[model samples]
Target: MMISLSRACVLTAACTVVLTACGGSTGTGGSATPTSSVDVGKASAVTPLDSATIARAEKQGSVLLYTNADAEQMAPVTKAFEAKYSAIDVRVLNMTDPQTFQRYATETATGVRTADVVMATDAVGMLNFVSKGNVLDYSDPNLKNLPDYARLAPGVVAMSEDPVVAVYNTALIPKDKQPKDLKSLAELSKSIKGKVGTTDITNPMSFGSVSNYTAKHGDAGWKNLEVLGQNSGVESGNGNLMQKLAQGQYQAAYFVAGSVRALIEGEEAAKVLNYTYLTDGTPMLPRAVAVTKKASSPDAAKVFVNFLLSAEGQEAACAGGFTPYRDGVECAYGLPAVEAVVGADNMMLGGYLEGIVKNKPEIVTRWKSAYDR
Candidate 1:
């Protein structure tokens, strides 16, 4: 099961293929020796659908969606889809990225193929499934409406760029005292120690962050990961981690998805938590979604995916607190527009997967060893 977020209103809301040797053992979990560097490929493009797609989708009666996004993050999209179709039922399954991936894999392996769509914050994992032929090759005419970075292979698409940012208790850390970057935050976390929380690196998105950080900053990034791991407690899900943060169990959390919804809930609870992107460069992780290869309702799946990438859907996402992959749609909550914060070249999606998702067993094992110690 996916970990459920406890707080409310928080609306809110990779890549490719190269490897090389770096100076130090790099994979956060593998061997102590320096790891190799990697270059990733961009998402492949799928042929766009004709105008008849939606008409066909209405005949399916329903579409089953499996997603890693919590119920709150998905409510608006589901509501919008159902509202627009008004006829087809959209049944959603909310679970952790790992759980969602595993369920689809298990079902596909057994030929059960229950889910029509799969969505998650783990871009690399979704892409891996795509490579394995688990996700369907889908095209939407709306694809032209999105930035090139949003499409991850012919059938896969990125829905939003939710930054992995710092979340601090405003009441505890004054504005002036807030750390400006991950390194500075690491220094501050040493004082708080167990009071700092973050998702485990084994989660593909976090793992990708580590790999991308190392690729970007080399030894410095690896050192930062060690310092971060040494100073913080590991948590399993964003909702639970943020809940603890709101209650002041942790003074701050590094790498929580900085969605507008989360920030709003902090205010609703009378907590003073605030989120900010890192100064150097924050991991603007994209939540990639696609129709499953075994989709029993392929037509409905395509319609839903297109809706997610459409102007109306993108606007709804922004209103609901998600950073849309579409540019110039306006940002939610007082956050700067995503285009102003990061560029396509800076995304972790296309280039860092070689070390993160491709070598998962070794990377995760190494992460567990380092984390456990």
Candidate 2:
């Protein structure tokens, strides 16, 4: 109930409005029935589905997935599943994070549930789905392998830890001299002057993660960004930023993790371009996945979600350049595991939900003010 009011207030800019009669299913126990809103954040323990459930899911014939992840990155997982299951077809719909959530919400409200599974980078929006009782719980045995932060609430799990990174051209800045923290990055930017490149501040992935720096460290983090913003080349997207950096047009680029993943893990450019997680800590935008409350193929959703959180699926993800959530899963491009790169104290998952998402407009305004100065 509070979640609905909060979202309404944020979107409509209305103050102190009371919510009347929001509807949805209750928590994990007896999940198929609808009820009024409850404290959805409370954690509910779960167990693996029984053999009968698996048999029923196999009969469901198809599983529909809606996600924000690139189709190429998800293809391997789907292919592996098809090879094993052989009967149930996997249908994927690629949409923006907002589109994915809105479509699920619309379908749920109208009593027509199409998405059995959903994966998206909009952690805050995904949490909203949990708060509204839209998520269904499938407590797989693999949940034991994941870090606590990955399971924010009952029925929700983080699919990947997509950390922000700085990419540099090895020909210009050598591997050993790369910036390890924000302070060093600021110094490197000053040294390079106009040779520093950055993704556009207007991009959600860039702005959202950088907002963590601003929220967590306050003045110091903003000061680092302010220092780096001077005379730096700004590209509208990370791909362009990385391209310019690799071409020797820029010595370094800031906050382009996905593009850096391609350079390091997908292409032969790893020799020319290398990426680093900040010594202080990189902001992780976890791509969260969940089963819908009214999934037509509930068992298939459980099976797929379990596979994604499994060792084999995580290994495939690492091979494709995404950071796996489970401990001991091999890191992409031989980089250090997530635990080594991001300390518990340095993580921004809670900070993002508590501070950044609700006050995004003000943060963007502050960021613009600092950058323009």
Candidate 3:
């Protein structure tokens, strides 16, 4: 879901226009209006069968995917799926997390053509969709092979386990002073002061990562984050934060997406930028995927979800630079790589949608006070 600052603004504007045209509320206070007036309990369900599902899906002929993931990152997966299915055409629409939910809600509510499947990093947002009965609940058999955390919610499954990490300019922060954990990062922040940067906690993904870290260590974690907030400048996207770090505007950044390394450019920027998973407890944010309850191509959606969880699909995901959690799937920045540095126990899973949504206001207040911005 990494996007440049300019692209983010454009997407935000585009979403507002679409929502307005579809008569959908632009508010983020709660779930978008449900598409159907019928009780969610009585909603129709689809049970996938091997040949039957494929036969039906081929007839549907297409699956529209609305995702927060950049098209480049999802290109390989889509290509592989199309190659395998041959009959089903895959169309990906990239949007910000909030926009993904908003537009889907709007289009579906209006009975217009909309996404068959949705994927995003915001657990809280995904859960909101599930709560509103906008998500289809289909148990993919592949779930058995994944970790328990991969089952993000009743209807949602993780597409990847992306680690929240600390990235520093190697030339600026010496190896001896390189932070291995959050507490150490806070300790180092004093020396660097305003040169340290972090993600804006107002964003759901950032909030989830920070809150999960705090949950793992309790009061001590909050205290460390407070110190971090006090000393760091807040940025909106990991891409922007990493850009600033590389440009020497910030000496370091904590609670950053590990995938940011791929965005770094040039020999100078490449040589200076280095990232590490937090050892005390690195937050693994799940990139969640789910089929829509009112999906136009339910059969094709099932086929696509199954493919995404298969071995070949995991390989495609890894090729697109997403971290694959399936065992024996080798990705340079996969869960295993994070585990090697932080240990399995210290890899904090982050999909506490209820808790995060419940205390968002108070948490945001405390976070703002600490940063005083």
Candidate 4:
């Protein structure tokens, strides 16, 4: 079972993954070395893990991760990490992006033992975090292996590349009528009107997705959104929108997170709901992860962060339903799939905090006016 922690119940539950016994002279468990060479796929080389660092991390024994990722989605990766490093206990605290930031801030202010690591999808918030010197400046060796965009800041890195997509109830919208791109979605909106749904731009992720596309297509992009806004209802999160879509409350939802496909429950809902990456542009939100300067177990946190960027870790994340962005690690919802449908040029990378922060008010106002909400 997935273990979920919150501010109110920190460290109350533990779901440790103990797949094998600790071995090796270094006392770091598992067959794979931190620097073990493997087929890097698109990457040129794998970063070697320092044996001394691993030993230090083992001594630290525990690492606490505060993230916006759903507990269920993170369980497999956490389990895999623990199975490899049996001595290190991994604890995940799940919260909203806002909550994660606020809670960490409060804890930091109070000089309390806070999260060893943090992960969130809000680019602006993360940029602020980095600017405030909240993140540790420990650059992992794996940083060199990832794409340039993956390195968001000195310490922060992209944990996953999740695409925002259009999801529809198949029973309500015929295959012929379903949208293939934002333009089609805009056209379909006229027929569906309020029956069409979209994310609330107030949310950072939602704003990032909409703004990213609009930034790329200029007037044409805004035109598409203007049409969508006039016709669509709004939800705060993709999961809620998906639930409504599956229930037939909304015939379709645009800019829904493709990752929500894993959270869909019930056979009936699964049969009715289907998603597609918009052909015009698919906004890829790279969830960022960073270690904190105040981490109680800094060494362990470094180990965990390095593992996340490793090939084995990417594979484990894929198993947990995240869209892996690393080369050669294929998932139906991965970067390659989106690229295949929309073309590489159309994959819009969202969450540039600096730009978003500057233009958010105007964007939100324009979005509200377009949607009349």
Q: Model 2, range 109-222, lDDT digits (tens) per residue?
A: 798857999887655677677788878876667677556777756788876777777766666776667776777888878778889887665666767667777777888888
Off by over 4 Å in 1: 1-3, 8-49, 108-113, 260-266, 333-355, 361-373
TM-scores, one per candidate? 0.80, 0.75, 0.84, 0.86
lDDT of 3 by residue, 88-154 (tens): 9999998888999999889988989999999988767777789999898988878776667778888
lDDT of 4 by residue, 60-97 (tens): 99999998777767889999999999999999988877
Worst 10-residue lDDT window for candidate 1 reads 14-23
Question: What is the model-wide C-alpha lDDT for candidate 2?
Answer: 0.64
Q: List candidate 4 segments past 4 Å from native.
A: 1-44, 264-267, 350-354
Which of 2 and 4 is ahead in lDDT?
A: 4
Candidate 2 regions off by >4 Å?
1-48, 105-113, 131-133, 137-141, 265-267, 332-352
Model 1 lDDT per residue over 1-373, tens place:
2335544423222001111211111111211111112222222233345657767888877999997766666788888879988877889888777788788888878888578988777656676777788877766677665557777676888776666667765556655577757888878877888888888776655665665566677667666767778778888767677766756677888776656344434323323555655654567666778898889999989888877777567667765556665544444421233323344454444422444556666656655665664
Worst 10 residues of 3 by lDDT: 26-35
Alpha-carbon shift of residue 259 in model 2 (angstroms):
6.7
Angstrom error at residue 216, model 1: 2.0
C-alpha displacement of 124 in model 1, angstroms? 3.9
Whole-model alpha-carbon lDDT for candidate 3: 0.73
